[model samples]
Target: MMYKKLFLLSGLVLSLILVGCEFTKKTVNNVNLFTIEDDINLGLQVSQEIANDPKQFPILKEKGNEDVYRYIRKITNKILNSGKVVNRNNFKWQVKIIDDIETLNAFATPGGYIYVYTGLIKYLDSEDQLAGVMGHEIAHADQRHSTKQMTKSGALDLLLSAAIGEKEAVKQVVGGIVGLRFSRTHETEADEYSVRYLCGTDYNAAGAAGFFKKIGGAGSPPEFLSTHPNPDNRVQEIEARAKGMGCRGNSTNKTEYNRIKGLL
Candidate 1:
């Protein structure tokens, strides 16, 4: 009986090792093992929750809104067309501006839902600067950072469930604590991806560097700082990335910039 139990225990241990290796492999490929369909579903659910929350800024709607959307779409298309974004074909991209002037923040959800606050737009002096911010947020989606976070958290929950003899409840907890940790890592990697993508686009890569400069002295830290890298550290990283890519200094579009600035 003892020998039989040892053999069964060894088999279970080997099985877990194989399962762990598979999970790690999926995560390392820069791709989430979960399907885009599932990601979009989760994103839609979370987005609805955010929309329902009182704290989220209201979505903006105005006359000539399509024009603004079209212009931003053009810019997004340019970057997406440049082959810099990963899994470009897998998403339906949407950008929304919240009409909140007090909050300076932007973020991208899985399945390509991006939100930018008007306060952040006001801070950007040019279209390229705007692109720098948008690109960074979009990079988070392209990297599937959120989905990967969900996957990791899910795996951990499964392990915990099995340990507690509640394997059936694993899926219920998959999108828990582990997901939060992955989300943080995804934010940092997306920052790097943004720098790289900006280098190849018409957007002034140095605008990214200058962006940090503008935000650095802003009296109070904004909501963006909670999940984003420190502006000072981001500026240094942007400078170094731009230097490696041969992008130097600000290259503003005077005409487009003035037009956008006039609106603010």
Candidate 2:
């Protein structure tokens, strides 16, 4: 009877706590309990691990490789600093060029550390497409998708404490961030933001469709695609979105993209 009473009291306390705190449902942009500082520290730790592994995953830090990185930097930074993105001053936005010339993917870690594989870069036709890819990834970061994912998964209680400043848990956190397969709604939301970000910039939002069309389904889906929407249908939606948003007459800058390819 004593044990039963303790359990009841514990439940009552939890209910009272919830009532006092006014705990609400977790929404796309509103469930954020982790502070911005947590994301920055987490991103920096994971990015450092990726940068150090040269044999398994080469960093594009060889001689005369600076210019291409600069080109990518300019594109990513432009979108990051485009004022279309909220909290522009808080993010530590940096783009890393992974030397994997086979894996056609790019991902953004929390607090705006983006990784672009060389294969995807080579596969894209122009710089505008590159910007589209970057913008999509940045949207994920801006939306704090990882934190929301953890919260929805019910692991935020356990992981939040470890995720902050815990180097040993870096792999787990990084894996969750990179391998997170966002829902269809999440994908659509990011796609919309991709168009918006490209709209205000020099790049055409339609360039996003080109990249999606090129590799709609090259191989089996990875973790990022487990919940991803169909790329073929996504291309059509993106194109229509671009037109609806009046994003015509935007520049692709194929000339500069050609130079970037040549430099690589």
Q: What are the Cα lDDT values of the candidates?
A: 0.59, 0.70
lDDT string, candidate 1, 1-264, tens digits: 433442343222322322222224434535445676755655555455445543454776646666566666776786676578876788777777777777677776666777777788777777776777777778767776655643433342333332243433322322221123333345456657776777777677756556667777566554234324667887787777778888643556767766654564
Candidate 2 segments exceeding 4 Å error:
1-30, 222-227
Report the number of clashing residue pairs per model. 1, 0
The C-alpha RMSD of each candidate to the native structure, in angstroms, is 8.8, 7.3
Q: Write the per-residue lDDT of candidate 2 for residues 187-228, one digit (tens) a residue.
A: 677787888888878788776777877766878654333325
Quick one: best TM-score, which candidate? 2
**Ten contiguous residues with the weakest lDDT in model 2:** 14-23
Candidate 1 Cα errors over 4 Å, as ranges: 1-33, 47-55, 155-185, 217-228, 247-251
Best by lDDT: 2
Error of 1 at 114 (Å): 0.8
Q: Which residue pairs in candidate 1 have backbone atoms (N, alpha carbon, C) closer than 3 angstroms, thus clashing?
A: 154-174
